[model samples]
Target: MSPSLLAALLYAALTLLLLMTIAALRATLVITRQRTADAFTPAGDDVSPFSGRLCRAHANCCENLPVFGVLVVTAALSGHADITDPTALWVVAARVGQTVTHLGSGRRRAIRLRFLFMLVQIALLTTWAARLLWGAMQ
Candidate 1:
């Protein structure tokens, strides 16, 4: 498979991992009879700090996945995998870095590092999209 496709799959896996973490946390609470299933807030505000960070991390993935997905799909469909293949894994790496940084701490330094990761991803993806579109127009 192309690196771009593999990156997309990895991105999806990362998202799923976050979701599973949230589910497991909630399940633990329910199973331990600490909280009812229906008592949890959607944003995880009522939960512990880690839960809140998990929710935010998952949400960040959800928010950005489609942008990455659509770009990767477009590249494949439009014969522009060449545009994305080189930096695809880098994008995934940045994505993972962003999430890891987000999950690691909520301090200002960590937040800045997370933002840098996110910026790396956005810049790479944007470059890919622009290249693909530009190539298509040729």
Candidate 2:
């Protein structure tokens, strides 16, 4: 029930989420590349996702992981264990939104919602970190 424990849990969850997202993104890239090449064969046809700038889905997830992990650890060390439950929930929500955004049919909407959730989660975590630091300085 301690804040530190909660923070640890959150950190673990965040790490797992980031790893899963990276795996999914890599798989998508591999599949797309294979299909593209196959379609371009002499007797094959063009069949692939639209050709354009690569999606940043996995990159974004990786980028956020460090921030989330650091905040959780900082909060735990600062004795703000009370914020763990909510922080973990927010992290879960953000991960859900991320998955949807990455693979859902309505990508634009999903991405928007995912980003919004991510912002909310980050704000909550930042607040927790600040509180922990403030408490330590007091």
Candidate 3:
């Protein structure tokens, strides 16, 4: 696989890891009788605050992952991996930053940082898309 493809897989794996973490957290809570497990919805009165953070973080990743995956996969498939590879690395960095920031705090500064990270990802993906489209137009 090309670097872009590898990065895309790593991105998906990391997102999967985030989701599985929430599942494990819920499972542990249910096992300990800390909370009862529920399907589909993330927020619940029975869940702990720490678990709530995990849930929300997982939800955030879930919302963002599809677009990122699509763009990266398109780049790899369309033979524009060379242009996308660096962008993918930067996006991965920003995505991790966003997740970590979200986990740490929801304060003004943290929210700003999270937004910045998200913007970085959006810009990187947009760049990748533009480059791919531009190349295809040739």
Candidate 4:
């Protein structure tokens, strides 16, 4: 598989992992035998902070995955991957960093770091697309 496609798959897999984390956390909190349906039915009643962070992280992943997927797929099919490969690598790395920072959310510095990582990934994506476009126009 092309490296850009591989990177896109990696991001998709990471998003799935985040989703599973949220699901697992919710299950642990909501599926206890001692609790009735009423107690667990409503959100924000007893969700863990970590679970909340995981939720946000998953949300963020969902928000970015579509664009990233499109860009990576286009790059993979473009046949001009000189910039795409490095951009893919950098974007994946930045995504990992963002996920880690998001998992450690709630701190000011952590939030800032997450934003920085997200910006880096966005920048890489833009660069990848621009390179592909430029190559196509040549």
The candidate that wins on lDDT is 1
TM of each candidate vs. truth: 0.97, 0.58, 0.86, 0.84
Better of 1 and 4 by lDDT: 1
Task: Give per-model CA RMSD.
Answer: 0.8, 6.8, 2.1, 2.7
TM-score of 1: 0.97
Local distance difference test, per candidate? 0.93, 0.56, 0.77, 0.76
> lDDT rank, highest first?
1, 3, 4, 2
Per-residue lDDT tens digits of candidate 1, residues 1-138? 999999999999999999999999999999999999999998886898878899999999999999999999999998888888999999999999999998889999999999999999989988987898889889
Candidate 3: stretches off by over 4 Å = 39-41, 44-46
Query: For residues 1-138, what per-residue lDDT tens digits would candidate 4 score against the true structure?
Result: 777778888989999998787666566655775444455422332566776677777788888899888777676666665667766867888988998887877799998998899999878888777877787788
Give, for candidate 2, the lowest lDDT window spanning 10 residues.
44-53
| lDDT-better candidate, 1 vs 2 | 1
- Candidate 2 pairs with clashing backbones: 3-81
Predicted candidate 3 versus true structure: per-residue lDDT over 1-138, tens digit per residue: 666777778778878898788778767877888665654355632455555666777777778778877877787777677888766777888888988888788689998999999999888888877887888899
Q: Which residue window of length 10 is worst by lDDT in model 4? A: 36-45
> After aligning candidate 1 to the native by TM-score, how far in Å is the CA of 5 from where it should be?
0.6
